[model samples]
Target: MNDNSSRPLRLGTRRSKLAMAQSGQVAQAVQQLTGRPVELVEITTYGDVSRESLAQIGGTGVFVSALRDALLAGEIDFAVHSLKDLPTKQPEDLALAAIPPREDPRDVLVARDGLTFETLPEGSRIGTGSPRRMAQLNAWARELGKEIETVPIRGNIDTRIGFVTKGELDAVVLAAAGLSRIGRSAEVSQFLEPDAVLPAPGQGALAIECAMTNAPLAATLAELDDPYTRVAVTAERSLLAALEAGCSAPVGALADLSPSPDEQIVTEMRLRGVVGTTDGKTLVQLSITGPVPSSSEEAVAMGHELAAAMLDKGAAGLMGERAL
Candidate 1:
């Protein structure tokens, strides 16, 4: 071990409640793994301070760059990030050290009067900052012959849910994993399955990143990496990269594993991708199932192949600046 092994590992994270909660969890794990104390270094990010909606201010990346800057400056040893917030392109100087096991990737509905999405009355107002959710919700509403208005919203989970409680909105769409991490999943009235609404690529997963030059620390963090989750999200993010879409784009993707009959082994992997207009009038969704990827190369290829198929079906037209 290097002399620094005895030093407390500083984990850079945003100061948001959700960010702190998740970072605390990772810090505990690192302390256990390295037999050293870990410290939380709270950093304010542009996304956290900006009242502007995500799409207007530049999507999820805004929440990440500040921490990345801290890492590159050697002010923090590593960082924890919601995987969905990471840009498709990785910085050359950093390493994605690990991807912990995922949480539930479904989107959840929290409605007033304990209403599920389907039970909500027509013309009910739903608040969400996600274009992907708006597109799918509109499409789903049309299918049910119901009309609901999607209002653009921005805030942390508490503020978002407050909208419903205050009668400002009928409901809100949020990531089930986020609520679960914050111990608020019980408030969810409905879990929107991938069948109706695919989640953003890499949703429900956490990424631990460190300076690539720090091989010893990177190797230590790699111990927490779950192979299945890594491959699954690799395929998902690769698809996003292939589509040339940013995190704010109206694009959703998920890569799921099919377990064997014994439920002890994964036998196949299924990749799904969707691109749609925010209005929900047009959508292009596609899926592909194949043997579980044995290597990272295979996973990347699978995503590229699936992305190609979606593009052939006119997925690009649905994306505004998301096109190649």
Candidate 2:
């Protein structure tokens, strides 16, 4: 324990409802563990202020850099972020002290009428800002021999859903976990299966970051880290790193860990990754299964290997294209 009870734990978070909800959860956990009060410090990020498309905003770091700045400057003792928003490359001075257990890492389609993808009308307007979701949805539409339009939309979950409710869009794609965490799961019309729509790397997970020198704070955060979740997200993040892709790139990956009944204590993990064109015209996906890695480094290596296999099959060119 740091024995700094006089100073409350300062938690930095974005102002979005989802971000607040997630950060609040982490704050509650820390308070429970340390029996100390925690204060949440809201930080507005570029992603929150920019009306320009994500690609124009310099991709992955938009949502995270501000928080990192706060952490480095001691404006806050630590910060929490959606792991998916974090860049694959971490800053050297900051440490990812904890990755709490992951949530459902699947994309969900929210429609006004509870309509599934197949049941949607022809030429339906689907809203999403994620190139990865757009790519998958378009690809699936193509396979089904249906014409669909993907509209560029951005906002927090509620605002995005408003498009559908207001009849501007027939449906929208969002991460299932985000909706679930904010008690908006009822808005989800269909949970897109992983095979149909792989999630962005590190989706549905939270990252707790603190200064590298804050060993005491880091040690406390370690108590919140779930080993299985850490291993799985580590592998997925590693794959993203190997592809040299930013968070906004059309990249999706997921790793699942399951306890082996035969081995009693051993667990097996299956990792899946994809790189695709923003327009859904091309894609390369790969999957691998192995025993859960004992260390974060090993898990990351597995992800890299899977990404390399996909790249060898022409994933690079697809991932390199400009967002549509």
Report the number of the highest-lDDT candidate: 1
Worst 10-residue lDDT window for candidate 2 reads 315-324
- Please provide, for model 2 over 48-99, each residue's C-alpha lDDT reduced to its tens digit, 9 standing for 90 to 100: 9999978667577899999999988889989999999888888899989999
Q: lDDT score of model 1?
A: 0.93
Question: What TM-score quantifies how close candidate 2 is to the native fold?
Answer: 0.96
lDDT for each candidate structure: 0.93, 0.89
Candidate 1's TM-score reads 0.98
- Write out the backbone clash pairs for model 1: none
- Residue-pair clashes per candidate, as listed? 0, 0
| Alpha-carbon lDDT of model 2 | 0.89
